[model samples]
Target: MNIRQMIKENNRLQDAMTPDNLSYYQDMVVYIRSSAVQERQCEELLLEMARRLLDAQDKGKDAKDVFGNDLESYCKEQIERLPKRKGLSALQYHLMIPWIALTWFFFVQAIVGFVTMWAGGPVERMTQVRISTLILIAGGAYVLIHVLMKWMKSDAFKPEAAQRKISARNIGVYVAITVLILVAGVWLGRHLPVLVIAPWVSLFIFLIGLTGTKLLFSTK
Candidate 1:
């Protein structure tokens, strides 16, 4: 049958089935949708599977009997049998491991830094800061090495296309901001007690580390 015909049949079955059967069919639809099948193929397969499931329900069989004990696994096997489509290469996943590890390391550093600043004695705080810094540096080096390795070996690791040009006015604004921050930092360093500045600096570092880590690990 055509895709539309199959879909209509499935929907009719869905309407006719009991709530429990309907729920199982809905989950099957979700699994099929999420499988690595091509869009057109997925639609056809989903409807086909739904129709079969409905047939089994009509015969008084449970979902497990219709789709086997593991419906998702069955659907995945079927999807894999379809013709190959474009997907992420193994290199992409290999590169992601180091990146994700680095992101998690920085996240942990941020948490440790904050906790140490709030709870530790002077010596303990200094020690924690040093340890966190070392961890951050090590994690960064590991990620950089993996990134460089991928860049050397794979075209897929190359940087994306350039974004919009920064206008002359934006450059001037950025310079002004940099100068303002430097001036503020110097002023604060000279006027504020170390104890007062230290906690804020720690907090600022924690926030930046957390944000950078989150951005690095965020999925498209």
Candidate 2:
């Protein structure tokens, strides 16, 4: 074939060898034509695409592994870049936040439960109203915790930030604890006021323990 005629035939054949076709002869011809420009080996692109597909499958199994690593890396960077004038040490400050959150939850729940009990158990048909209310409050708190975690997770380096997101979570836990205490108090208060004092004391104990744990871990 003449030079121009041969070039035209090659162009037509090259255009026909798309990835989806994987035709051997067509691929060989295109590979030769585009050798200088797209010098990748014949299967290079296909192999890379296969790797990406496998990676995607792995991510589907544990999306957290991909995003969580990024988040934790980001948090480390932020801590390292701090201006040093934030008062408390970075470790100390973040550590104490969870403790403070737990304490606040304990106190709030203790009060809510105490007040709820003091208002009298519940009406006849509304006997389960208190339980329902407590459940709703707890569910709402969980949602809030989830949202807060999602937002803080934007930092990409603080993957563990979500683990420490107990502010709203404490509310739900303490609320349940308080309700248990209130029920016990109501039952035992039939004879003495001692039962009324247990929940608060328990809450205080939990706060102390939580605070201690935070300090110990953060100091490391």
Candidate 3:
């Protein structure tokens, strides 16, 4: 029978069932319908399941016996066995990457600017320097994260070769990086003359950094 007929029959059976039976049937239908399987295949699967339920009920078996106790888990297991559909196309990725990168860049800058202003960096010039420095840092970090993500996806970077255990060496490396960043920030704060740098310079650097990040991240 066609899917439409099967659906009508299933609805008729559901209408005749008890409240708890109806609820269970509805939940199972939802779980299966939400899966990535093709619409025709999903409908056929549901139709078969409904037929089995009706048969079991006629034999005087409980709903739990007809469709197991854990319907959700059963549905998940079945769906997992289905082959995955192809993900977004390259064109879609290209369209989306710039927007995603811009979002991250803006979010990081906003947080940095808020914290700097709250910390009482002089509103006139020092605040601008701090904000500029932060924008550059954030841009650099954004590029780094994308680079690392790419590297992680490479076949050369096998899961087995990855460091599963965190050791003192890793902890020490992190600490060293943190210290260097703090030192660099302090040095810039002290040595960089806030007034000597034009406001346009910061804007230009930010724009350049943003463009560089987009290019670095968007390339395959």
Per-structure clash totals for the candidates: 0, 8, 0
How accurate locally, in lDDT, is each candidate? 0.57, 0.43, 0.59
Candidate 3 lDDT by residue in tens digits, 27-77:
778667655676667777777777777787778776688877777677777
**RMSD of model 2 against the true structure:** 21.1
Model 1: worst 10 consecutive residues (lDDT sum): 155-164
lDDT tens digits, residue span 153-202, model 2: 44223223453675456567668766775675555445442222334563
- Candidates in descending lDDT order: 3, 1, 2
Which candidate achieves the best lDDT against the true structure? 3
Give candidate 1's TM-score: 0.37
Which parts of model 3 have CA positions greater than 4 angstroms off?
Answer: 82-220
Candidate 1: the clashing residue pairs are: none
User: Top model by TM-score, which number?
Assistant: 3
Query: In candidate 2, where is summed lDDT lowest over 10 consecutive residues?
Result: 33-42
Q: Per-residue lDDT tens digits of candidate 1, residues 38-94? A: 666877777777677778888888777877766556766887888544555575545
Q: Give the CA lDDT, 0 to 100, for residue 105 in model 1.
A: 50
